[model samples]
Target: MIKFLSALIFSLLIPLSASAAEYSDGNGYTTIKTPVRTSDPNKIEVTEIFWYGCPHCYSLEPLVQAWKKDLPSDVDFKYLPAVFGRGWLAHAKAFYVADLLGMEDKIRADLFNAIHVERRNLNSEDALARFFADYGVNEDDFRKQYDSFAVNSRLSQADAKIRAYGARGVPGIIVNGKYLVSAESANGNENIFKVVDFLIEQERQK
Candidate 1:
């Protein structure tokens, strides 16, 4: 059910388009050593490796949301919380728990807002529980699932994938698992999507 709902939400995130002009090498992204292939050959997978506590990710949130509004239908975007830093795994768990509870889309921006804008301390389980409860999510239920096997499994998979992408920092974007782009490479938040769109076009032609 989780995967199905996630797919449905992804399918509706953006628009549709075809190929584009050539993309120069080393402009804004790096090709992965072993490209991570997508499950659906018909869809180009775009994954963002981010941590909620990351200020850069927070700043890029609005731009990414705006960019996603018009994403080509053949592109599928999903968030992969980077758990490389201290206390990051806990936050990753929160993300999965939110998804499990069907509140990911509802609270994703709010989580970023709470931490960056509202200055809420959601670093720990107790703190996050209270934060989620404010949204009417059952505290007990959230806590239970937060530590469940399913969430843990997803976190484990995320750890492996982040390492595979060779992302030394947060807020990395991987297009079709073949290219990696970040603020440093893209030069700015807004341009990251431009690089992604270019990569998606590159993949579409294949």
Candidate 2:
């Protein structure tokens, strides 16, 4: 009887030892990592895959911004616009155009607001040109880059990256090229960042 009890206790403690890291959330949406820590040999890259037309992505933007502001110096954070389908591809083009024109900071959030908040249909180059003109971007220059091979190629690459990430939906995050942190995770979006921080610390320890 004593031996059996000791074996049972050991089995229970084994699982607990593997999941020793803890995270806090005032609400119920918080998750921790599993035992097998996933790591990448390259720099710690944190990429957020989102689409401008996604309301959830829009809602998460502020939280993402906060995270970016407080991100550690060692972390490399990037925003990769996702082209999940025909509807999302246009926004992806706009994102690349902004990137090529060196106007991503000025226009990325506005594009999101235009789609989700303002209910504007910027689904075509003509519409996008009008939108850019309103924002003081020269219409011709915007059109040139919008139709440029560079922008188109980058958009293609973005689409490929989105597919490679196996993103079932928008507003998903990929950490260090391996661990995927999605809202589907037990902790949800808020906990995703916590998991990321934990992973970064784990890497530092190594």
Best by TM-score: 1
TM-scores, one per candidate: 0.87, 0.78
Question: Could you give candidate 1's per-residue lDDT for residues 130-181 as a string of tens digits?
Answer: 9889889889988898899999999898888888888899799998888999
Where does candidate 2 stray beyond 4 Å? 1-42
Candidate 2 lDDT over 1-206, as tens digits, reads 99999999999998877664453232222222332222334567788888888887888888888889988877888888887678777788788888777888898788888888799999888898999898788989888887789988888777766666666777877766555566666356666677667666765676
lDDT of 2: 0.74
Q: Relative to the true structure, how large is the alpha-carbon lDDT of every model?
A: 0.86, 0.74
Candidate 1's C-alpha lDDT?
0.86
